[model samples]
Target: MTYRLKYGTGTEAVHDAMPSIESEQLSLALAAACEDPIGATEVYGEDDGVMRTLVTEHAIAVLLVGRITKTVTVLQLSYTG
Candidate 1:
C-alpha cells in the first residue's frame, strides 16, 4: 500500500476528498518520508488544490509527495513495495 501525489492522479484523488468545513480539513506536506495508503486515507483530497489533504475515516492523516516529470507535463510517482 503506497500513497503519492504526482501525475495529477494522486492530486485529483486527494483534492476531491477534502471536507466541506474549513477546520475539518487537514493538509500536510511530505519531503523525505512518505505516508502509506493501504487501508488509511479515505477522501484523499475531498477538495480542490487550494487545500490538499489525505483524509482517512479511521482518523489517519497522510500527505503524499509529488514529483515532476522530465517533460514537465505530469508528476510521476513511484513506490517500492
Candidate 2:
C-alpha cells in the first residue's frame, strides 16, 4: 500500500534550500532509494536522526521513519531541482 504524505515546515524549507554538491549526491541516492530502499543501502542523517531518502526530478525526498497507528505515513515532502 501507498503511504499518505504530509509536509512539515522544516520539510518545506528543504524545497528552497538550494542545490549543493552534497545535495546532488543525496538526490541520486534518494532516487535509488525510492526504487528499492533496502537495496539502495545508502544512509543519510540529520541532527534528529537517520532517515531514508527518495529523490525525484520534482523534489529531493526524505522519508522520516515512524508509525502513526497502523499506517505508515510520510512525515514530510521537500523539493529540489
Candidate 3:
C-alpha cells in the first residue's frame, strides 16, 4: 500500500507554507502511515521542513531525516487514516 498527500488538489495556501523538503517528508510519512495507520510519533520542524517518524508495535521508534527550512511555519496538522 502507498499513501501520498493529495497535493495539487488543495488550496495554494497549504503549499505556500510548506517547503519542498517538508513536502517530501510529508509524502514519505503518509506512505508509511498507510502501511500502518496505527503508527504515531512526535514530528519536529526544522529549517522550514518537516520530518517522518513512526512507533512500531514493538515499542521501538524509527525516525527519518527530513528537510530543513527557515520559513513556512506549520500552523496545524490534521491526521487522517
Candidate closest to the true structure, highest TM-score: 2
lDDT of 1 by residue, 1-81 (tens): 233334345643443454544213323323112343322233335533222333323223333333221111113222211
RMSD of candidate 2 to true structure, Å: 7.0
Per-residue alpha-carbon lDDT of model 3 for 1-81, expressed as tens digits? 333233222323443455666545664554555444334345544422144444332222223332222212223343221
lDDT of each: 0.31, 0.49, 0.38
lDDT of 2 by residue, 1-81 (tens): 223344455764564375776456655554454444535532456533236555555554556634332222234656544
TM per model? 0.21, 0.38, 0.34
Clashes of each: 12, 2, 4
Candidate closer to the true structure by lDDT (higher is better), 1 or 3: 3
Candidate order by decreasing lDDT: 2, 3, 1
Candidate 3 Cα RMSD after full superposition onto the native fold (Å): 14.0
Model 2: per-residue Cα lDDT at residue 2? 29
How accurate locally is residue 30 in candidate 1, as Cα lDDT from 0 to 100?
Answer: 31
Which ranges of candidate 3 are over 4 A from the true structure?
1-17, 40-81
Given candidate 2, what's the lDDT at residue 69? 29
